[model samples]
Each structure stands twice: as structure tokens, then as C-alpha cells.
Target: MLLTTAAVMSALVLLASGGAWAFTGWASGRLDRIDPFGALGDRPEDGPRGALTFLLVGADDRSGLTREELDRLNLGRDEGGARTDTMMLVHLNRERDAISVVALPRDSWVTIPGHGPAKINAAYSFGGPQLAVQTVERATGVRIDHYAEVNFLGFLRVVDALGGVRICLPEPISDPRSGLQLPAGTHVVDGAGALAYVRTRSTAGGDLDRIDRQQRFISALLEAATDTRTLSDPARFTAFSETVLQTVTVDDGLTGGALLELGNQLRSVSMDDVTFTTVPAAQTDFTAPTGESAVLWDTEAARELFGRISRDEPLAEPSPPAAAQAGGAAEEPAQAAPELIVPPADITVQVRNGAGIQGLGARADEELRAAGFNVPVPADNWVGGTVEQTVVRHAAHRADSARTVAAALPGSRLERAGELGDGVEVVLGPDYQGVRAVEAAAPDSAGSGGIQAATATDNVCA
Candidate 1:
């Protein structure tokens, strides 16, 4: 939830340009820094050029708090190590004129670098921000250009500094651990209440539900923070900046000036320009080999979901399956016109194993041959690790062939890889079922089930 963070970041640009040199000078010292990507080797340089992605982590660390204040806040003993209670991938597509904020469930199962498969959030606990950044980049093939962390106290202070944020409650709820107790209705919650609202997992949908509420709160926070009252007041603006600067911990790439440039890029962005969604998941109560309950993502859908973001493509609502439709009448897709169709035999493909399943690459290669398509031998591993879905990528000139190859492989999504050489490149995800006969088209929608979404302009309720 970047309600306050987004507001602060977006408004910081204005402050930097409005002759707040003294404040900027003061801010340089206030903001903390950590090189989250240091151990990960030289970062990839060819990320989406016109877009920037930041990993915003809400840490549950209670360090640096006086005993008295901790007790007064009802905060229990400091959790020795910090774990991200909330994580969001904030994407700013400068060329596309859109800002996408995607919330990732902490409980989602993923492979940690050193540890085996575990909750995505555990990446932070296993090795702090570096591991967390690595985990996210591997899980979602999108490159993380920046990282930001805010602890419990920092979040509380930010909310308090802004005079609190308004939230609508569906029913009365009380979560002892988070110390959140609220009546059913729309109410403005203070720092503590805001923390509790976002941290509580006792509700119906558990963490998944909390994410929805966080997204809503972010919208409300941005609306209130950017309101005329808050922006027009010189004193309030300065105070808010001080609170944020002291709280947010960013990577080296997000310097004050870099942040201002990011803000400048997003200056034209509005509530209408902001869209929020969660990574698609298959199950929430999946039991890992270690017997720990974790969230299982819908691999195929999740890959396509993040792949689109990596390419700065618009995220549209998912279309329902033909079988799920009334009367089960299949509508042939219009986007796959005859001119856009290429015979499987006429297409050449290079298969890359992104699915972690052993021998999947070889199997996919064999399947492609059986389907009468030319497959390049000796497939390579998708850099980073496994993916959730099989994707067909091609250069701009091979768009029609990519679509044709996609049709041959059921459930595969097509992507344009400008850097790719001739022919289609198939990155098989973990969900690769065998290659099948080219069939009617998949639905035109860009997203699918288990993915929750809301635009800043929407009145989304948890």
C-alpha cells in the first residue's frame, strides 16, 4: 500500500522544484540506504527502458523503539529479524502513461536462493533485503530497478504525520496480535489503527484479503495527501517530508535526485492513472514439503501477468474460459486473423527451459518436433530460474509466427521480444502440459483468476 508513500514520492518532486533546497539538503541525511543488489552481481542493464519498477517492503521490525513507547503502542518484543508483512511491485511506465502497483502475498510459495522452497516473504528473513529482491526477481521475471523498506514505526509515523487515513470496514473486527479493533463503517484511522488494518490476517480471506484493504487504503491515502488542503500548506508539506525521509530506506539507485526524477516522470500520473493488482495464485493453503502452509501461485497465469508488466503492456481484466461461459459456445478470437496465421511447419522455434521441472526442456523440445515445428536443439535455461507459464516470444517481424506457435501450445501466452533473434523463442513454464493441436484462440483478456485488481479511481471494497 503506497498511499502515503506514493503521495510523498509524487509530491517530493514538487518540493524539490519549489525551492526546497534546504529541505533537500536536510533530506539527504534523513533517508537511509542499502545496496540490495550488491551481492546479486552486476545488475542487468537492459530492463524495460521506459519503465521503472520498485520493490516496496513493509517490514515488521521493532528495533530502535524505547521500551515505554513499545509498550504504549502495545507492540510485543521486537521480532529479532524483520520480515516483510506487505510487498508491492510499483511499476511506472513512462511511455505508456500508466502506473501499476501489484501486491504480492507474503505467503506465496517460492524458491529462496539458499533455502529450499518457502514463503516469498521468508526471502527477507533468510537474508534480508538482498534475498528478498532476488526472490522477487526470480519469481516474477520483471527486473527490480529500486528497493524501498519501511518498518512498523516508520509506517505508523507516516500515517500519523498525515493526520490519519480514512478506511471503510465491512464489519466489526478485532485482531489481538495486530491490536486492531474497529466498528463496521467508514472511519478515519490513526497511525496505530492503520497499521493494524493492514497487518491483521484474522479476516475471511486472510492475507489475501488484507492486500485488498491495503490497496484501498493506498488510494485513500494518495487522495487525501494530494488534496488541496495538504498540498497548499507549506508547514504540513515540510513535516510530511521529514517523516517520510526518516522512515523510508532505499537502495543506492533511489537517491534524492533520482527519486525526484521518478516523481517527475509520474508527475502527470493521477488516481485514474494508478492501477493495483495482485499476482495470480492457485491455492492459499498449499502444504510445502517442510509441512509449512504457503500460497501456491497459478504459474502459467502469473508468468503471463508479470511478463506483460516487464514489457510495459497494459493489464486488462481476464476473460473467462469458453467452457465456463453460458452454453459453452466458443467464440473464435478475432485477433488471430488469417494473415496473422502461420503454419506450424513453416515456423522455427527455440525452446528455453524456464520451468524448473527437470527434463522439461527436453520434453518440450520433443513435443514441438511431434507437432511438426522446427525446434533448435540444446535449449538454454531461462536466466534467473523457473517460470510459471510457457511463453512464446519473437521479434517484431515474427509476430504472426509467435501467435501461430502459441496456438499450437495450449494456454501459452505470446510476447514480443525485440531483442530476440529470428524465429520464436519458447520459454516453457512449470505448467507446461504437452504441446497440442493448434486450436481456436484463448480469450483476449490480459489477466486471470486469483488475481485481484483495482484502479485508483475505483471504489474497491475488501
Candidate 2:
């Protein structure tokens, strides 16, 4: 009798597992059928083997919201049309050891294939997901393996089902417009609060800062949703799946066995294994032909970064030694310039001699030259007595270059002198000589100087 009971229990377990699998398959299929944009209909043949890319879009439309939801959330002016406020490309590598989430700013200006230059979000409005996918693919040279678009209502529901998410706030957030009020530090955010947090863009850093927050929030959500506790709760999983299906429109390739297989492969990945980064952009205010302020892509850095993704390589981290190596050092032998990499030539560095000692500007200029900066003339702008810090200046249009320069000088404090362009200006503070030595030796430890060559080759606005 005991053996018979074990057999019956095993069969019941198998049946339950099979049932859940069937349900997920059905839900995924239903989602594919509801793709009003027909973005998923085109399946590229060149997709990486066992790898998947999902263009996850978060739309601002609240049409699907119930009257109570609208009232409770205080959503105003139910704009009947949809516009994607958030765009993320989620890459599941073949080995699943790493996942890359690349966020494309909604206000980014890109060529829309048939529609000339336009806001990236406009691609969806023009030709729906198909045009958006095409624009992204053309821009990044990475094909879209799958697609998923979620509305505001869907996002709120998912957050609610997850039993609230924990968010780390560096400062108190009070956005009356979005109805978000939260104290500083880490706090548990519910559905409405999560929505507001991800959607808020009025803070100091604007859209870039908001994207960073959204990435963090999504990371937390992924952790909670994939937790063993959440997975074990069949009722919660069913509700979550239903909510997601009802609101999300996915590509055909993302349905049925494809999605189930992808999910199974990703079951082991944790939040820590995922990395999210915004595409590098010029720190300039782009005035469109229509006089609208739009952001332009930092063509050089962004292209290299995306190329690495297309090749399944990890994103390059700043190597101080590599920077120093590219700058040239008498102690180290120069190697061959890296292939398929281009460094910008119009780099400018401003050297201010703050050291009380004489000839500090000349010395700093020499160090910069050794570190590969083209300095036209050294200036003696030592307004402060005894240099205490170093400042690097780059035009807002050249922020990426400033970041690259700052990375080479890791220990030195970086002050943004938003007055220079495609250039690096150095202020010789008290510790100028020490900082120079530290940065000069950076290239020795960085392997082959290939990464530096890559950075140098990257054009600011391409």
C-alpha cells in the first residue's frame, strides 16, 4: 500500500507540472496573437544560437486601467494613443552567465528608416514595433530576436503581484505631479509608488537619472518575481501570468516552447548577474530642425559598446593602465594599434597650475602629453593657493570624452568643467604631481592597451 501511494503521488506531481507548462504556453500564444503592431511577425534568420533578445517596451498609455485604478492612481487625461516611455533590450546570452539590459532614451534622435530623423519613440507611432525594431537594429547592428510591449496597467499589476519591491533612494523623493512621496534610504514600494518612481524625470539628472532608477527597480523586480517563494505560489504565478499576457504584446518567436525554454534557461540567473547600462550619448542639447531639444547618441562609445554585445563579448571596463599605455611611457614598449578601433584626434586638455611650486603647468602639460593629450598651451590660472584637487573640463557635447579622461585618472577628484569640448583640461591642485604619477602608471597593468585604443578611437558625436 505504501508503494502504491508513492506511485500515485509521483504521477500527481508530473500532472501538475505538465498543467502549468500548458498554461504558460497558452498564455504566451494568446499574447503573440494580440500584436497589433505586427512587430514580431518578421523573424530574422541570423539570430545567435541559443541566445535571445527581447525588446521590452513600457508604454505610457493607461487605457487598460480600470476606472478604480485610474481614480486610485490619479491618472489624468487618458491619452487614447500609446507612446513608449521606456525601451530596454534584454539580452540572454547563450551561456546565461551574463545578461545585458540596454536602455534607449525615449527622447533619443535617430534615423527612422523611412521617416528621416525623429524621436526614437516616434518609430512606434509611425509603424509600431516593426519600425522601432528596424530603427534600433539599424542603429546598433544587433538584430531583434523577440519583442514585448507592456502598458502602464500591466506594469502596476506585475508590481502588485510581487508583493511590493524594495528600492534604494539616495534622497527623499517628492514628486507631486506623479503622486510619489518617499523618504530617503531603502523602502518597500507598492504598485503605484513603483510606477511613479520609474516614470519620474524631473530630478537633477533628468532622463539619464530616471533610466538608472528604472534599471535598479527592474533588477529588484526580477529578483522578487523569480524568487522560489513567488514561483511556488501557483495562484500568484497564474495571476501574474494572466496580467502580463493581457497587457503585453510579444513576437511569435517568443511564444509557446520558445518562451518556456528561454525562461527555463534563465531560471538560474540572479539580479547580480544582470548588468544594465544606458547607450552612451553626447552631453549636448540637440535642437531639431523643428527647434525641439532632443538628445543625440554618443556615436563612438555607443557603437563600440553595441558591437561588443553583437559579438557576445562583455562590455569593456575602463583600464587606467591601458589609458596610460596609449598616452605613451618610456618604461613600457608601445604595441600595435588595436584593429577596428578609432581614437578621436581633436581632444583638448586645459592645464591650470595650482601647485605653489613654479613650472607646475609645464610639468602637468608634459605629463598629459605622455598620457596622450594634445595641449596647445599651458596656462597659470592658480587662483587658489596650493592645489588641493584636479578638475577636468569637457563641453556638455563631449561628456563621454570627459568620462574617458576621468577613468584614466581614477584616484583624482573629477569636477565637470562644462566649458570645453572634445578635450581634457586639467587643474593642477596641491596633489597634481602625485595624481600624474598614478595616472601615468595606469597603462602598465591594463592588458595590451587594446581597451584604451578602443576608447581613443571612439568619436564623441560620430
Candidate 3:
């Protein structure tokens, strides 16, 4: 879902800065236009303002591909219907200083306009992008400001134009259906490989697993596009901008100036500032009333998430309110919850190598120390041997303290360990990608159909 959005965001920045002058004008003229939200007819009076939320749709429809290209890419004819394999609700904060990209599981059960309950993606299949936007608004109770659409072939060209994207895999994968065959490590993937990576769903976690991979793919793509080598090279920037504009279709509102505004707002933000997560959902095999298997969103949690977005509040934690004048009521000051806030200087951490990769422990020690944690315990091999997921063990009384430490190292789990005398012990596992601040907390925690987040800065293998 974000593949198109990420590419467009980078292009918009280049356009806004006049970095691709000739290409920008030419590509801007060639951009495909769509009335994505026009069918909805009217905007709600209570719709959110100040912030912008875009409904990014990735269509599996292959309508515009040439016969030879389709055959070459293994894409069959268009089935006379449109279905989005991926949908994401992207939110830009009021200040445009941060971004939260929420992936919407296409299989999630929701109501379609003029139709009863069905898989959310079916809305697009039934009526196109307009109905898809309507269904999302009705289901989440959050108003969407804009829409963007891209097809499979367009995605391929864009990635190829940007050279290639690098992705890290913890284990080898060979999915025949998607044509993605790769070893267990990092590789720079070309267009076809990128498509296969995101399309394959035979992995362990099912659609959920695919969703995670897609999110990671978006981050990696953005990081690659923003690299100094790509940015400084005019030829690379021109090719990227041209391919992206030709590839993506946006609602009428995202004109060149509007795009420049968006790009300017986000100019200073880094990949580290952007966060990606999925909409809370539970996997289910139960048949819907429409006779289709669907993913069920945790209704209670989903509602709360939309509510926060409606008020323009940050989803992770309390946001500072607008300040009031001297005679007026002062806005409540936002603060990190006690459970989430732990000063790096307050605790000591022991680094152990469980990843089997040589010098992993020593690297972790250096990273933790730079992050302000006291790494008094020298890096050593873990007695427990090689593990899969990273774990942070701490004394019983310092569970919250451990969580704080884990926050600094995103993706690591917190556990109880009386063996660690005072602080926490970080055993870097095979899954240990790197050290970076974990994303903000979600409305619901993991394992409960809540949002799972990953930082764009972390190159962790998905």
C-alpha cells in the first residue's frame, strides 16, 4: 500500500524543491487522474481538519498493461473488476512533522456502501475507489482527505527507476506463485523481485505476515530513495520522479502546488520520524454473511483509534494541547506515561550475543552506550545459545524499567529474569536487526489485535 505513497512522497519533495524541473512538468502532465472520493458526494460537517489522512489503495487490476508485458510479468487479463490487495490509512500530523502509516487488512470485515457486510476490499471490487473510500469512512469513522491509487505494473517501473530496493530476510524464501526466491540475508532487489516479495503470502503468518513485509518494504523503499547518492545525482532523481508520477494516480485535489505544500511540510522529517503499523485486526476463518472468509477488526479498538485521529491527537500517547492565554484555562501538558518513560542514565544493561553473527554483542554494546544506557556488563555469548526473537530480561521489580529499555530498542520483548541483578540483560537474537527507538505505544498491545509498529530507520529483516 505504502509503496506508491512512499515513492510519491519522495517525488513531491523533489518537485517542491525544483530538483527535477523538466521532469516534474513532463511527469506532472502525464499523471493519471481519478475521482477516488467523488462518489461519496458530501463531506461530513464534523470531519477532521488541520491534519490530513490519505486512503492509499494498491489495485491488483492489470487493465493498462500491454499483452507482451502482461505475459512477461505473468499478469493475466483484467477480470472486469477491481480489488485492492492492499489499503493503508496514512495520517500526517497537524504539524506535518511526523507520519503514521496504518495498513488496512484488505480481508477485514466491513460494510460496503449499498451493500451488507463483506471483506473491505470487496467495496472496491464492487464499485471502485469511490465506494472503497466511503466504506473506510463508515467503518473507521475517520474522514479521508485524499486518495491515491497504483497498479502492479506501475509499481514495478517505479522501483526499477529508483535502481533497486534492499530488504533483509531472516530466513530463505522460495515462493513459486510470486517468483520470489532469495537467500537468508540482505539483497538489493530489482522491480520483479520487489513485486514478488510483497505478493508472496505462503509465509508463516499468512496475510498478517504479508502485511508486515509490505510495511517493511515501504520503509526500505523510502530510505533508498532518500539516500544521499540518489538525491545528489540529478539523473537518478529525474528518473525516479518521472517514473513515480507516471505510476501513481491521485485524487484531483493533489495538484502540483498542493503536492509542493505537502513536500515542504515534510522536508525536515527523516525516515526515523515516520512510523508504520497495521490497523488492529484478528485473523478469522469464519464465513461472513456474504459467504466470504474475512479478517475481523477488533471493533472496540478500531473505534478508539479513529476517535483519536478525528480529534487530531497522536495515536501513541497523550499530545500536548494548544496553549491557552494567561486568563484562560491552560492546556493540559502531555507527558510520557510512567511505564514508558525510563531515562537511559537510570539503568544498566548487559549485552549478550545470541545472534551467532560474530561481533553482534560488541556492536550492541556500542549502540546501547551511545543511546545512554550503562553497558557495564561486557558483551559475551549467551549461555542459552542461538534464539529467534530478541528478548530483554530484567529483575522482577524492574519490569517497567525493562520495558523502557526495550522501547529504546524496538522489537525486543520484555521478560522477567531474577538472574539479572539490577538492570536489564539484552540478548540479541537472530532477529535482531539493529538498535533504534521503538515506535510510540499503540491503543492496544500486541497479541490483542492492536497495531504493531516498526521504525523506518531500523533495517531489521522482516
Candidate 3 global CA lDDT score: 0.66
Point out the worst 10-residue segment of candidate 1 by lDDT.
320-329
Candidate models: Cα lDDT each: 0.66, 0.56, 0.66
Q: Show the lowest summed lDDT stretch of 10 residues, model 2.
A: 1-10
Question: Taking the tens digit of each residue's C-alpha lDDT, what string does model 3 give over 1-462?
Answer: 223334334433343333335234465577777787665765544545568888888777676668886665555555655567768877777887777777788788887879888888778888888888898888888888888887766778877888988877644788777777897677899887887787777654567667767766776777777778877898997787677776677888877667656776677777656766666654445578768777887676676667766777655432222344233322221123234433465456878888899989988998888877778657999877897878776543344446667777656765544223234778898887676653323334431223334455432232
* RMSD from true fold, candidate 2: 12.5
lDDT of 1 by residue, 1-462 (tens): 212233323333332223343235567667789999887953444456768787888777777778886766667777577767657888777563677788788788888877978888888888999988888888888889878777667777767878988777744778787778887677888887786776677665666667666776676677766777777788886776677777777788766676555555555666766777777666778888989888888787687778778888766532222122223222224245233234566566878889877788888888888888877555778874776777776543345556678777777776644333235788899778888766322223422322334566452222
State TM-scores per candidate: 0.67, 0.64, 0.70
Candidate 2 has an lDDT of 0.56
Query: For model 3, how many clashes?
Result: 0
Pairs of colliding residues, candidate 1: 299-388
Question: In candidate 2, which residue ranges exceed 4 Å CA deviation?
Answer: 1-24, 34-47, 66-74, 317-462
Stretches > 4 Å off in candidate 1: 1-23, 42-45, 71-74, 317-451, 459-462
